[model samples]
Target chain A: MALKLYLDRMSQPSRAILTFCKVNGIEFEEVKIELAKLQNYSPEYAEVNPMKQVPAIVHGEFKLFESHAILIYLASAFSGVADHWYPADLQKRAKIHSVLDWHHSNLRRGSATYIFNTTIALAFGQPLNLEAAAEGEKILIASLAKIESFWLQDDGPFLLGNSQPSIADLSMACEVMQLEVVDTKDRDRILGPRKRILKWVEDTKNATAPYFEEIHSIIYPAKEKLQKLKTMAAKKEPQSTGEPA
Target chain B: MALKLYLDRMSQPSRAILTFCKVNGIEFEEVKIELAKLQNYSPEYAEVNPMKQVPAIVHGEFKLFESHAILIYLASAFSGVADHWYPADLQKRAKIHSVLDWHHSNLRRGSATYIFNTTIALAFGQPLNLEAAAEGEKILIASLAKIESFWLQDDGPFLLGNSQPSIADLSMACEVMQLEVVDTKDRDRILGPRKRILKWVEDTKNATAPYFEEIHSIIYPAKEKLQKLKTMAAKKEPQSTGEPA
Candidate 1:
């Protein structure tokens, strides 16, 4: 049976996994679980991943969630995946693991929190949380700075300074891509100061080519729809203010 | 050179790594990084782990951090480590990785955040964040329920239902140990209903024996000290109440 990848491209991790599959030419069937429609909570989807998160996989009888794990599994199990994605050398692999693990509490947390507070929350009929957004921004910037000074300190374009991109590069780059859905000003403010991060993200996208751009193209339209909603909400606010108290 | 393990037993991940080393009889030199003293922020510690987190390892000049990554590295690189701790079978290893990765954003986040807000925050001279603690508690319970129903669904004693403990079992059990430092009432309320979680933790502790208790012995004294401080603070409250406004 072909591997089943349950995903929604709107999710950062989902996009990373999708791009990885495309880049490696891994044969799989895509099962879409739309987060916006709350399909992730459906009973059928729950069987594939009780966690109800995207980027889960079912290879025959084996079921796996958590994108990092899925990525590692794909890299290790599939003979086609290049070694640089998850090197065989114990030391090199360990360093990549370090980056992947550090990502969870730091980069992934910051990006997801900030994007949800600023944009996605509105789609869910929730008000934007400025305080939480500010906190998320703080961590996000610090994470970017670390990527610049530490992870990218060497000469190579990719994270950990490898000539070729690894799962860490793809995962972190896709996370940074989430900033695109937020206000342009906010996104620029976060990315503008960090030259190395900006370049590395572009490098990662390039390394993973047309598929990377193709998968990520969903974010632009989503951003436009969100902006239109915000504008409509702003226009309605004045009418509410004029109503009799 | 012996593997250099930089850790602070007070940190759950640190203790996890420390216990793993002891259980496998992996030779190592323990270097303490006292979090309470803010030694993690020192330049010297940064040289060991640029991220400045505990449970980092320097094995023959190849430095690695993130406890999960370190545990994975130790298991793979050391011939002395047992196979069941990290099976060579592709599917088995993938499932273990899933548990380890799922742990970061769920169990570890919930346990760490709750403990920090309720107990550790006071030690850092910060008042209790009741709001954050409540939020953390909700996630912690949900995470525990998932662990009970999903990961421990099978007949085995440890997580993922393997008879022998794996790195996932140790890492998660250590994380749950953080709840030990919180108030007894709070800890019991959170854990009392979850019979599987309680038993599994004990099973993991027993599986990883003498060293598990030796390393984790620190938490009891730490818990006692926190309780004493709470009692003193409560006693002083009435005196403040009697003072003139």
Candidate 2:
């Protein structure tokens, strides 16, 4: 039986897994669990994943949740895929695991908050919380700063200096790219200082190319909607009295 | 040169790694990083792990951080350790990874918050934030409830039906055990209803035995201190009015 993958493209990890499968030519049936509709709560889906989060998989009799875990499992189960994605060299792989594990508490935290509070809210027509957005911006910036100072400072472009992107690169770059949906000014202010990180993001997208674009295409509609909301909101605001103020 | 591990017993992940090392008979030099003393910020330690977190390791020229990553590295690098701890069986290992990754955002969040706000604050003579403690307790209780309903429903004693404890068992048990330092009522309220989870906790401790106790010994003093504070506070409170006013 072909592997069964449960995903929702709105999630960063979900997109990462979809892109990974496409890039590696892994055969799987995609089951979309739309978060917007809360379809993940359905009983049938709960049996497959009690956690009801996306990027879960069923391979033969095996079941797995957590996108990174799924990624590791896929790399191990399939032959003929590039080893750099999850290297066999113990130290190199350990380095990748380090980034993957660290990601949940760091980059993932900031990116999700920044996107949800800013872009997702706008797309849904929910009032934006400026206070929360500012806090999220701080976290996002600090996280980016850490990546620039530590992970990206290694020789060459990718994390751990590999010429090709690893699962860590795919996972983290997807996380950082969520900043694209944030208001342009807010996004630039948060991501602008990290020069190496910006370059790495472009490098990863270019390397992953068609698959990355294909998986990420789902977000474009939401992004455009958010942009339109911003334009509308800006027009509704009172004009500033430049001289008096 | 021996593998060097930097850790502090007060941190749950640090204790998990320490216990894993002891159980697996992995030879290493323990370098204590006293978090309470702010030693992790020192330049010397920062060179070892730029993230400045405990439970980092250096083997020969290779360096790794993040406790889960370190756990996976140690399991692979050391030969003859029990397979069930980090099983070579793909399905079994994937289940373990699922728990480990899920832990950081869920169980770890609640337990860490509960400890820091209630016990750690009392130990440091800082005022306890009742509001935050309540929120933490809610998260902790919800996380425990999920574990009981899903993960612990297996027929066997351990997670995923393994007779032996895996790294996930060690990591999660250590996290949940942080409730020991919380105020008696708060701890009871959070952990009391989960009978199966309590038994499993005992089972994991017994399976891992001396190492679990030995690694967790550091928390005893803090636990005792918190107990005294609770008792003293109880005595200082005004006697309840005999008649309903």
Candidate 3:
């Protein structure tokens, strides 16, 4: 059976997976789950992923969720080369694993908040809070700087100097791309004031552009609308208690 | 050069790494980094890990951080057994990997906030937020429910059916043990709210008691002080940051 992928382009993880599969010449049917309409909470969709996070896969009898896991699973199931995609040698993979883990809590988590919060500001007619925006920018820069100094300093388009991008690039690229959906065209202003990240992000994105293109249409428009709706929802209920503010 | 494990016992991740090394008979010098005082911000440490979260290891020239990454690395490096510990098969390992990843964000994160806020509650004079105590109960129960429905049901005594515990058990055991440090011992209330989870926690701790001895010291003090300091801190800060009383 050909593999089936569940995705919503509005989600960065979904885009990363879509881009990766397309870029690597792996085949799959991409099924869109519309988040703007709350399709993720549908009983049918909930059976696939109770957490309702995106970029999951169904391969014959196998079911998988979590983008990092999906990225690795696809790479392994398709390519059969562990080399640097996720190195087979003990320590190199561990470093990749360590950075990947950090991406969620520190880099991705903080950056997502900055992007989402700015979108919130745009929707609500509120100016972006300088303090929160500044903090987010600092964290994004620090995280990117780490990637630059530790992994990308070899002066190549790819993160680890491999001709092709690794799962690390996939994870980071999805996050950085989400910044583009923010209301402001020049998001790096809030990301880092006069940031040094432009060079590395350009290189990383350019290297991974083919993958970026595969899922852009579905996710891009939905993400724009989600920002507008979020502001509306916030205005209706500022501290709606159970709803994530 | 022998493996050098860098840790601070106060951190649950550090303790998990320490416990895994001891249980597995892996030898290493303990390089303690004081996270409480923010030693992680130093430039030298930044050279070691840009993310700078703990349970980092310097194995000869190699450096690894993130407790889960370190655990997976140690399992692979020492050529440990496949059955009870980290397995090699694609699906089983992926399930385990996914849970550990979730734990980093959910259980571990909730507990970290619990520790910080409770410490704040103690330092600043205020009534312990019953809401915080409630939040603690909520996350832990949700974690237990997932384990019951997904990983464990009839397979008792441990997660993944190990006569001896795996790094999964070690990682979770460390975090769950910190629950004793959580200010609310309102077991009757929380258990009444979520009965199955209460039983699971009881059983998980009971099963791990054999190897759980070394960690009891750190856990006991933190938990004990949480209950002890609740009143002390309550005296310092006002309760209900929610609204003006």
Candidate 4:
């Protein structure tokens, strides 16, 4: 039986894993778990991953979740994966691991929270939290600054100055892709000054090619829907209740 | 040159790395980075870790940060470290990685945020954010429930039902140690129902032995100071500003 990949393209990590399998020529069956529809909360999906999050995998009798772990597993367990993605050298691998771990608490947290508060919250029937969005933006900007000044400081095009794209590169670039859902002006303001991050992300996307573009196609429509929601919210009249529309 | 571990015991991840080194008998020089004094923000420390975080390492010329990454590096690069800590098998290692990544977004986020909002925030000269503390507690409770039902479901005493403790176990148990600083009633309310988590933490502490206990000694004093602060705050009179005393 081939490896089974449970994912939802709407998720950044899910897209990373999907692109990883495609780029590496890893054989896997794609299983979509729709988060918007609450498919991830289903009991059957829970059996596959008790965590009930997408981008999980099952191979034979073994099961795993967490995109970083899945990417590492695919890179190590598969036959044809390039070495630079997850090198055998202890020092190089350690640096890559450092970037991956940093992404969870820093970049991922900021981007995900900012996008959710500014745009996705309304789609889920929640009000836009301007305060939380402001807080998230602070973290997001700091994280991007760190990426430009430190992670991308070396001459190499990828994070930690790796010449070739690692799983960290793919994972982070996909996370940055999430900013697309924000208003055009807001997204530009956040990413504008970080030239190195812009170039690095573009470089990573180009390096991965058509698969990267293909996997991220879902984000475009979501972005459009969010913009429309914002316009509609702006047009609403103020009521005596003084509640957010 | 000896391995240089830059750490501050007051930090949980720092303690995790320190304990791991002693347990594995990895020879190292401990360089204290006092977060309370803003030592992490110093230019000199930034040279070592641009992220300005504790639990960084400088091995010869290569520098690394993020405790999960450091632990992975130590387990693989060192000769005496046992395989159970980070196994050679692809699946076992992948499962371990899953837990470590999950720790950052879920367990670590919940515990650290809750503790900081409830206790450490005031120590840093910020007022207690009861709202943030309440939110953090919700996440913490859900995380504990997941750990009990899934990660510790197997017969084995440690996370993922491992007979031998892994890096994930040490990292997570150390994070739970942060809850010791919370109000005794609040701490018990959060953890008392999670019997499996309590046992697993004890098992992990015993497995790591004197090193775990020795590294965590700092938390006790910090806990006392916070309790005193809470007691003093309760005695303050109501003022027109309605500010938290």
> What lDDT would candidate 2 get against the real structure?
0.82
Tell me the spans in candidate 4 whose CA falls farther than 4 Å from its real position. A234-245, B233-245
Which model scores highest in DockQ?
4
Please identify which of the two predictions, 3 or 4, would achieve the higher lDDT against the true structure: 4
lDDT of 1 by residue, A167-237 (tens): 99999999999889988998888888887788888888888889999999999999999988777766765
Q: What is the C-alpha lDDT of each candidate?
A: 0.87, 0.82, 0.67, 0.87
Model 2, range B178-226, lDDT digits (tens) per residue? 7777767777877888898898889988998888887777777878877
| Clashes by residue pair, model 3 | A9-A219, A10-A219, A19-A211, B125-B236, B125-B237, B126-B233, B126-B234, B126-B237, B181-B223
TM-score of each: 0.95, 0.90, 0.82, 0.94
**What CA root-mean-square deviation does each model show from the true structure?**
3.8, 5.9, 4.6, 2.7
Candidates arranged by lDDT, highest first: 1, 4, 2, 3
Ranking of models by TM-score: 1, 4, 2, 3
**Which 10 successive residues of model 1 chain A have the least lDDT summed?**
A236-245
**What does candidate 1 score on TM?**
0.95
Cα lDDT for residue A142, model 2? Answer: 79
Ten-residue segment with the worst summed lDDT in candidate 4 chain A?
A236-245
lDDT of 3 by residue, B1-245 (tens): 57988787877788878877766678889877777567877888876666676778888888878888888888888854345567777776776676677776677766655554545355334445545545654666676567556645455555644344567777876776555555465434333554544555455445545445665676666566556677655576665633336
Candidate 2 has what TM-score? 0.90
